[model samples]
Target: MITGPLCRAARALTELSREKLAALSGVDEHVIELFERRIAAPDANVVAMLKSTLEDMGAVFIPEDRRGAGVRLKFTASETKRIATLESEGGLIRGDDVP
Candidate 1:
């Protein structure tokens, strides 16, 4: 299930405008706007279409876990290595300083 924020994040990750997403998913642009605004819940079919379109575009939806639900990009090995390099260089945080 795609939550509002997750849907928004997926769109952002894919560099998709609301109009583009609507065109791809066959959902109305206004409905997508309302969904992202958290003002309305779309029908299950709409949700499915959004998810399918995003997945086809390389967005993976993480199921709710202890940390929470989220969306992530499906990266290639070189991209994964680049992210690992950044993390190893202290470009990312692991929360070790949290009290």
Candidate 2:
């Protein structure tokens, strides 16, 4: 199950607005907003719908465990290449070389 913070983070990472996510998930806009704000709890079906929609858009939900939960983008081939190039150009640290 995706937590409120994780859901919000996924939306931010995917550049998806509340309205956009509502439309894509077929859930109400207000429902999405309230859920993301942690003001309301959505039922299981609604949560599943949101998670499915986000997964389709490349957002991978990390399950809660001892390490805690989160979300991250499932990088595509182009994204992988772009990140590698950026790292090579000093936009990011190479390998585990960050100080």
Candidate 3:
């Protein structure tokens, strides 16, 4: 669980929903929420997964060390919907929180 400003910005700029992001990233949505909330540190794999997913959708995610560059994410509403559907359809999400 690694949280950083760069990661937060990426989450905000991306169209992927938290649940879908986590599922597609092979992580729990709660962990994705943690990263968005900046409450937990996202490990290298988590960062890598997120970056890869974004890149596949035509977004360029810069690592924390490379945040100074003009990296950007380009996604339309339809693309977002598509990505969400892809992730959700795969049934990657697994959670049964009682709280």
Q: Which has the better lDDT: candidate 1, or candidate 2?
A: 1
Please report the candidate that would top TM-score against the real structure: 2
lDDT of model 3 at position 58: 59
Return the TM-score for each candidate structure: 0.75, 0.76, 0.54
Per-residue lDDT of model 1, residues 8-93, tens digit only: 99999989999999999899999998998899999988999999999988899999989999999999779999998977996655
* C-alpha lDDT score of every prediction, in listed order: 0.91, 0.88, 0.66
Candidate 2 wrongly placed segments (more than 4 Å): 80-99
Q: Give the range where candidate 3 is weakest over 10 consecutive residues by summed lDDT.
A: 62-71
Ranking by TM-score: 2, 1, 3
Q: Give the C-alpha lDDT of model 1.
A: 0.91
User: In candidate 3, residue 99 scores what lDDT?
Assistant: 85
Ten residues in sequence with the least summed lDDT for candidate 2: 90-99
Query: All predictions: root-mean-square deviation over Cα?
Result: 8.7, 7.1, 17.7
lDDT string for model 2 (9-98, tens) is 999989999889998999999988888889999999999999999988889988778998889999998999998897788564458855
User: Higher-lDDT candidate among 1 and 3?
Assistant: 1
Compose the digit string of candidate 3's lDDT tens values, residues 16-61.
6777677777878887677667788678887778767656655665
| Pairs with backbone N, CA or C atoms under 3 Å apart (clashes), candidate 3 | 1-40, 1-41, 1-42, 2-41, 2-42, 3-41
